[model samples]
Target chain A: MPKSVMHATRAGQPLQPVGRRRFLQVASVATASTALLISGCNKDDDTPSAATVDLGSGDVGVLNYAYALEQLEAAFYAQIIATPYTGISAEEQAYFTSIAKHEAIHRDFFKAAITAAAPGNIIGSLTPDFSSVTFTDRSSVLSTAKTFEDLGVAAYNGAGKLLKNTDYLLLAGKIVSVEARHAAVIRDLINNGDFAADDVVDASTGLDKAMSVDEVLMAAQAFIKEKITATNVGK
Target chain B: MNLFHLISQVEKLDPQAMDQLVSRRNIFTQLAGMSKKAALVAAPLLIGSAFNQVLAGNKDVPAVFNYALLLEYLEEDFYLQALAKPGLIPTGAPMNAIMQIKKHESAHVALLKGALGGAANPRPSSFNFGAAFDNYPTFLAFAQALEDTGVRAYKGKAGEIKEAGNPNDYLTVALQIHSVEARHAAHIRMMRRGAAGGGIMQAGWISNAEANGAPQVVYGPGNPATTFPSEGNTTQAGLNLVTALGTTYTAAEVSEAFDEALDEATVRSIAGPFIVA
Candidate 1:
């Protein structure tokens, strides 16, 4: 399980709610601070809240979800570029630079588009926690890159069905492929022939993995500081 | 509520629920036999394959799916033929990557045929690979083009598939397959650039329609310029990405950021020369 559950309940309550108080607390806090905890709270403990954001409903929610992912990816690549891991080849450095640019563009594109479409609904700039990653080690860096890239692909694949707008679906389609390409390259960097391994691509179906929104957020929760609620996303 | 959620619930109960139904070969009769709640719980799982069988119910989806199958067949055939040649691919890393890609293409072919069932298009008997088999670099170039085209083709069809079904989940399936093609394309590009001569130096992602030595037709605008723009397109959703953000990004970087789709007509025209059905 991810350190935190991205699905929301009421602030100061446990991950699951018990009664009308939970619903009432959630409603009262919806337009307030919206801060929930990122650290794993006990199943039944009444926890204090901090650093949380809610991905709103419908198309705006979907865009915010995408934006949240882009922010995570862009931050990752930017960090990779900022401190090149030991023994990183010149070629790998150059490739990382290009990838950083692509991710940054994706992040900024979502920001601009969302601001124009629904300024208030756009998600805030997320704070990434890359403490788990060892920037000094090439193996650690590339492996983390592989994880993020694969996660991005699966998230987009799963999210496609949730999109009500075809244009947004197409846009997601465009970016997911690029993320897949990144995933492939990163995998190859780790293991020359493991670009599309059986783990990532189903041996029986030949399709890449499609993770649900909750699943994606759970997987990504460890890398982020802020808690996120995607319950209303695509509803 | 989406029926897919129910399907997920049923899958949790029995992971092979759809497969068992598929083996029975009378999904509709079976669904009809079940109680309405059970059928409601099972319909989305059935829709994955039966939706194609229900071709008469929706022409648009089958047409788009068939086109996808055709492209998969083309790619599978292309990889199969190239892999068949003795020593066409290098022995170490190159061979390993090609073999992996070949397996994936074959898997994609199997998945598409399985999904489409009787409606699936038959594979072409012959292929005209010209100089692709003559040298390793040439093979890589052709492989890159086909993989890149596959990515774009699937992207182009997303709208078609999304519009056709009542949450058929084919759109998600197509998206799943779409990313795998991109992975293949990037690996092929890696192999090309790693070649000793540096003759086919290329980025893993498309950069300003740079075909390197691959077919130019794969990168240019398709039938209608508006719908299927060139791979070098810098503008997305009406804003030039390079200038959209306050930060400065080169046009090449902006273009490399997002891939563009090609219409089905243009994709068929590009792949038509090699397929001899």
Candidate 2:
């Protein structure tokens, strides 16, 4: 593998170069006249187009879609740890810190896997604005955590069908379950022992609410200023 | 102009465009002034109706199939590894339960393959079970981890088919598989507590209190101190396990044991390595 790829895998960073040889191949393809011309065309056509990160349609799109969400979560938690919340109990801080580490690991894991499996197709980083959030307040932080976690569960649920890859689906299953746990914990923090209530999960179906890519994008758009689009997502 | 003249002029233009133009003009608004009824009537027509659009375009068979196949590989590999070890499962009832669980996981692999249908990738020659179950402590830990993860995976993906507005056929099959996985988790927790005199384990779970209370005492069957369901009907099926075992254990007690076995940190820790690196 290339040094960059090795470094990325080690550091758990997204957009790792695949390998020296593969990098050359990709570089060659990029520098080739036809490819360059196509790239140029895309750059020039600035007709108020929605900024979208092409996930390459179908199952690939779903994976990239998930990858994008993981990135957001990872970034959020990373920020949380970088600046520890004031007045947080030691136990609570430890718990949240561990969770932040887990999320970061998850984000990087997806990035590495996607890079290895499908190079040149990773979703770009979203510029998140937490202006409305007051991280100092425990309740405010927990409430925000609850919303993100719940949104994650619903988003995963909604995106599952669009996923064509069972491996990705399985991976998603693993991640979402963790997200559910996070949701439950945050819920408990807000209200004693109200973790798995009827509000979050439907009693009859035993399933969380499902939100489509469009729905999630709209919800996430509030925090994210950049226009993130999933190109080549669910075909 | 008179109402008749206005109506005639409106009829001359394209109906759709003309209606929009008139609606925009609010001639009715000018005529009726602050009339709310006109607004209400026009709102429905002016605002387009919402309908579920089925954007069933291209289904990516390779990506979808590969993803499902990977999970099957994980489950299949876990059981294969567990079954390979000799003294992991006790003989008679405990062994039987493990065998059944192994069979169910195998069935899951097969069922998932079937779902993948033709597009399924060829199975990998081998799988790296990683450092999850390096020792007995790790083995139990991994087992708990897998079961918890399996439960979550099912919960997470069950709504996918629903979101696509697809038929419930796929979701039903997936849920059935999910329930089986949960049962396996519950049974494993029972065996871990050395229930049933270390052999011929019953279906009921051993509460943490019971497990920690006495050294040799199995909570169910012969013990009178432990509570079980009476010989009557109840709404919940889980309680029936207690009844079947002839033990007096509350549903909450049984549930707590399951909860204790599947902790969130443990689940995250087990899955974390797999997800990131």
Candidate 3:
């Protein structure tokens, strides 16, 4: 559940695939010097220098960022359910189990989408650290869930503009709605109807929170062990 | 509203006369967009023409805005009606939270109206705004469906909305409102659980297609067919979820992983019943 994937380059392609002359150039290089390039294109060669996780720029980076957040959520929910938070009801247990399943589904969806879209360029799964979370306490679990869910929504919101491809944008839109749904549920679980509470939505504007990749990563980095960076995102 | 619907409304006008009401160029531009990019190669110029047509006493670009404005009016009015009725909202957190929701919807209505100015479609004379009973369970049940529908509806037509000049501004506003609708869906679903005497809580997202044995139900039998078909769909960009990710996730989990967009037609149909005479 703590798994994080790191990919090279950015998120999915936004514009139509670089067509015509660019495509021919890439095609020629591929077929012209097959063996030497093939031999050089091994897994070891693909890792970014210094091994720091770089979510590639543009749409792919956004997808990677989303994949990382979903992984964190899946892991957190799994832990709470596995240990069973103190005094957790059978009902609450069932509810969180559903949440855990949903996060896992989301995590796997991104993994599958990224891999299908970028193949070798896809990020590798990441490992997470949860030392600070008090798994035995209901308060801690729900609060953490709230944080993850809200962060997920904000990340998706902020990343929407970065996509040049409407398809990727639409796909991200699909997931962000679910994340918002999760955020509201977790908030209500902690305190009913605090779903779009003042903290998350600006009282004056009434718009829901949206955080840039850098802002979301600041809160996300502590729970994740990877040396993640997002400067190239949307670039 | 969509182009075909708008076109059908203007069928009686002669070409030259209609040009005075709504530009022929702008209508074709909107039609090009609605036809899913048949003429998209001319996008920048098409959009420029569209933008100019809107500003030049035509309701072309504003037609799409009016669609959004109309929906916001529907939602704001629905919430206000619910709040007016006693016993629909339970006391304390749920009620207060819903009140905030109503306010946000109202703000959305106002925001769109301000953006549209004179071009905004007037609100329908009245809305149905119900799944019948005035009890909390009934109110929340309808609220969940409405909000969920709103999310899909926005996503479905976002491409259409993006055509009204600035792609950046239209998309940003649509997404902002989309997430809020999702939040509302979740909270209402959560409250409905309490009203129904909770067992295991439903996942905040729709878990599966109603056709494929989704564990939880979303819309009732009466909702238009497109509503559930879209929600239950698990395909994206020609990739089927279960086929692509089946090894790791169960079929249900695979379905839960992605939300689907309804076509503009489906969106109009979904909102059809709620538009009371």
What's model 3's lDDT at A223? 71
Ranking by TM-score: 1, 3, 2
Off by over 4 Å in 3: A1-51, B1-61, B130-135, B162-168, B196-203, B210-229
Interface RMSD of 2: 14.0
> What is candidate 3's lDDT per residue for B1-277, written digit by digit as tens?
3544444443332122244335545556565566466666555566556545334323343565677777788788888888888876777777797898988888788876765665567889898855543666666666776777777777665655444333325566667778888888777766665654652246577766542111133332213444324465666655676676666556666566667666555557767777875
Which parts of model 2 are misplaced by more than 4 Å? A1-52, B1-277
Model 1 interface CAPRI class: medium
Ranking by DockQ: 1, 3, 2
Chain B of candidate 1 achieves a TM-score of 0.79
* True contact recovery of candidate 2: 0.02
If scored against the real structure, what TM-score would every candidate get?
Answer: 0.81, 0.43, 0.73
lDDT per residue, candidate 3, A31-123, as tens digits?
344334434443333333334688887778888888888888888888887799889988788778777877887787788888878776567
Better of 1 and 3 by lDDT: 1
Model 2 agreement with the true structure over B33-104: per-residue lDDT tens digits: 645887677554533221121111003222333454455566667767877888765566545555555655
lDDT of 1 by residue, B1-277 (tens): 4545645643453342455435435777889999999999998787655544333224566577778888888887787888889888878888777777778778878877776666677777887877778888888889999999999999998987777642346778889889999989998898888888765667789999999988999999987887788999988888888777864798899888898899998999988988877
Model 1, position B112, has a per-residue lDDT of 71
* lDDT by residue for model 1 (A1-235), tens: 1111213432344455333323333333333444333222233435344478899999789889989999998998999889999988988999899999999999999999999989888988998877557788887788788889999999999998888899888888889999998898888888887889999988767889999888888667667767888999999
Compute the lDDT of residue A161 as modeled in candidate 2: 66
Q: Which stretches of candidate 1 lie over 4 Å from their true place?
A: A1-48, B1-57
